[model samples]
Target: MTSYNAQEHHLTSTTCLPKPGVLIIVVEDDTDTAHLYQTILATRYHHVAVCHSGSEAVARLVSHQGPAVVVLDYHLPDMTGIEVMATCRDLEHPVACMMVSADRLNDQEAGCGEAIRLTKPLGCQTLLQWTAKLVHKVQTAVHGEGPGDHAPENLLIGQSAAMQHLRTLIPRLAQSRSPLWLHGESGTGKELAARSVHYCSPRSSGPFVAVNCAAFPEALIESMLFGHVKGAFSGATRDHKGFFEAADQGTLFLDEVGDMPLPFQAKLLRALQTGTITPVGSTRDVRVDCRVITACHRDLAQSVREGAFREDLYYRLNVLSLALPPLRERQGDALMLADHLLESLAREERIAVCPLDEEARNWIQQHDWPGNVRELENRLRRALLLCDGKAITVNNLMLNDDERLTSAPPPSQAPSGVGIHFSPGRMTLRQIEDAAIEATLEACDGCIERAARQLGVAASTLHRRRRRQAA
Candidate 1:
């Protein structure tokens, strides 16, 4: 391998021209492609090198003296792209590489580099954009600025009392090493809460691994959690590290924990108590230290009573528990979250920002939101993609007034036997609309023309309004 001296490669002077200190090594066997890349990078960066094989790339990486970024092709003449990355890793050099390939292959195993798959005729603009991003990322890392420094703002957005309460508890939760058990209906931001805890904790520098217990097959749940050794069972070709071991010194989020098999729960309990795990078909125990965070839509307490869950394991995971209130109970948070989702979608899709109409806002508040935050997100995403105007109407959300009316208790059945008693302080505008629509429909015997006349509006206008309300 070719190696360069670092001391001799230092920048000697600073002038108006771009510094030639940043070294870029390109590994492309295709002569035309290599020349094209060299020309493209020459326009912006000053230092660039091209190698035709993985062997040559590895040699240059070991010998390089200054800061360098490597752009490697997935297919190399001497070895695979991943093999070249392994060589750079073995040398212990701080080289950031981007893997360029036309095939959908695993780039992670090849080395720690960004993976960009392009067709035979790659666009120059796309190539430059990827190169710029990779270079900037390497520069940031070299400056000792971690990835967390550039984390997106407002990861959890809301100002409702429930949200404010959660905000206050997150930092405190992060300080503790105990396993956190999160309970809430699906789509209520349980995953977001888990992420907040990880990002704010002392182990923020470490990896955050997430697994969904419900998604795993019942027969494979144990192997997935504790891992398996080579030949441990059928299809066990190689030894593997489980989530517990993978998340060492970091956070392991177990979503849908209630769905884990009862037998696996017993094994997990032992691991939690002893801080050790034994892979399948292995007698030796491996010690692991990781923060466990579990979430579930079902009530664990109920599951324990019914014998579907292990009582001992439940207690261990419940050491630090946080219950996320349903979206309907979060009051004004629905609107705030909707606005945030809409803005985010707009930015990501490069579309114009679409505001929710008053009627639509009312519909959002009135709905029960059985799917919680997830349902709201899906609705907004669909509206953004499907809406034709500047404002997202109730119709765009695909909700009906009847569904909203059915979710609320009848006004006459209020606790005081007079006015309705909607939770979270008072009834929202959506609730009011629901009530009005219900009463009007009853008065007009569901006659569209009669209802319009009774409500003092044009028939066509009322029909459109009704459709919007129903949606």
Candidate 2:
């Protein structure tokens, strides 16, 4: 669960924020999720009321009189989110509606008239982004003024075919309410990708609670995941809601799921299957409405086959899967992300934006980013503190000699397995290209995006080449 730590910097709202008397109605079925929204939005919009059901929301909106914004959950106990919006639309007073759903809701799917639709597991930033937009729009309509120009919007930046495809798939993935498994190497953006999917889906207005399974010890995993009644354990002084309850009607991202203890995996599986969790020291089960997204760096299938992981649990958890491409496989993306991180880090440190020198850029491009985006960010963070605020040079990067040797091939000689054999007047350019494509494609498990990136060619170009060859 995220805390409202930012004192007054409500960047998600207007410059004149925490708009007093600007009533905002939040319609959610889950108490925790409703409260989470209320807590975060309350920072910017002073009067934030949370309604537990569609009927309750309708009742409140009809009786309520003032300029207001509605954050409606798509799925509710009484009626669909659209029904609540329809009710708000018919009211004597007008209210701007922001509908939140678990799935990706297109205009046709979002039949709530003109409501702003967002997907579940919404972070504070995304919520603020949309709310600020809605608030500005309402203010403009009511007072005949435009929302002032703001800084650029943050987006997942990359031109790799893999990343492009991932961007296109996020909306579709966000729309799905099924359990999703994200498997990748360490430093690949599994959680980031999951967050993107969550924010883009219909549930974007709800809280996104992430739990690192590996972070906690095995002895207390259950108590941590499921709430504990007062006096339930050694440290239990009061009743505590666990991660499941906190993420109700939102998303629960379980990172390093493979690390979860085997014995406890059964209990977790039961909760997922039944859609209910029984708190420690309590007999009654509580119903939870949360989307589960699990990620790991291990081979779960191999674990399952070896009996280290339960097959039933694996099947249940792997409803949908997304394999993240490693940074090493994505050509030029490491440097692209490095540049993006440079500006962000500089801004965060309250210093002038630093530009990467030619040497630094070359080094970044050539170095195999084994740690991926996370590693890149960490390196830039160190560089930010070390550099002289003007330009980041090669010395500031401090790359190792061994990494350079492995990443950069001998200048006169081409790397092996790229399909380029330096033979005396033997191979044609077409032959070399074909070999390189074939080798790279094989290395990437037949993924065209990964292959195209490594070869410094567009995926479409590779596709055309393949088609021409086939013909």
Candidate 3:
């Protein structure tokens, strides 16, 4: 009986109509309301059935042929709507259910289930829109069509073996309700991977709430995660639903989870264990049902060993883990991703897709993308904007020499560390800069690109500085 708040969910769509073949069953005890629903839906759908009792609806649903969606009233003549839905769970043909009620239901009354629940006094348009969406969702699943927007394959884009393995692993992870741990470097698409898991799961229709653990202050972390009542603190003017409650009947993604304060780890562990949260300034605990997916760039096991994170909480969140490979580790993906990003950006910007020049491709292949996919995306976006109707050159990306040099050795070949010695004389700033740049270039086997990366400057910038010093 987890009621769907229309404002909260924002799931209104009227243009996307359901297919005529899908049957819609309206289960309302009130004949006038039932007639109104049947009349409205019958105008759009070929088959619309009305059932006044829970028993009748269950029998009809269990025996219904082809794809069907039922609108079940929370108060039925024989049984509660959830009970009806739960009983039909074993039906040979799956049916989508929407429970409508005048009375608001709490998470405890019904537990978080797959059925969508909406409060009564529901608008005719809202009812129709939700019913259509549900019908489309069921039919789409049954016919094996790709889901809208957040398809796992599209979200996790790459052809490398590592990516192929992830494509296989993500769906399997989605099938379970256990806590999921996504370990990856920054910009490695941990949140995207989490999203893939959510869209691929039974809870796709519900909210997918993401929280950045590091973004919240230490003092407010508890209240942000568990909510707060009115007048809880200074500036507490109203009751606030926290991340956990906001993500009920869906997924809660905690990104950069390693940065969560150690003291709060204990409370998080308790919430995960008990499936409940006690909001700030509230004495009673509210039950919540959501799949908790957590991501961190650093090693949690190491953090636990160093006592920065809780050992027990680590185990709790790490029930099932998926490690995303950084962009640098996924060989041959950099260029492929570059093309994809360019095309996507072009479409978004309403411009023609920009091609990468030979030098740009070489630089992309050679440079170490420490920021992973995010850095690549950012650089490509910048290049796309500045390329000015030309193929994107290394200069456009600001990562290579002004006069493009031969492809440099991969970053792995660059020296791990470069040491510079300043002559004992007090040197000007320009002299110091030149000495450091020379040392880095020498250490990188005279590869300007590698030297620039090491020196934290554009290869073109490094080349210009070196030439000026020589003159």
The whole-model lDDT of each prediction reads 0.70, 0.72, 0.77
Candidate 3, run of 10 with poorest lDDT: 1-10
Report the C-alpha lDDT of model 3 over 237-297, residue by residue, as the tens digit.
5676777887789898888889998888988999999999999899999999999999989
Which candidate leads the pack in lDDT?
A: 3
Deviating ranges (above 4 Å) for candidate 2: 1-155, 399-471
- Sorted by lDDT (best first), the order is 3, 2, 1
lDDT of candidate model 2 versus the reference: 0.72
TM-score for candidate 1: 0.58
Clashing residue pairs, backbone N/CA/C < 3 A, model 1: 1-59, 2-59, 3-63, 4-63, 82-110, 187-373, 399-471, 400-470, 401-470
lDDT comparison, 1 vs 3, better candidate? 3
- What C-alpha RMSD separates each model from the true structure? 12.8, 15.8, 15.2
Candidate 3: what lDDT?
Answer: 0.77
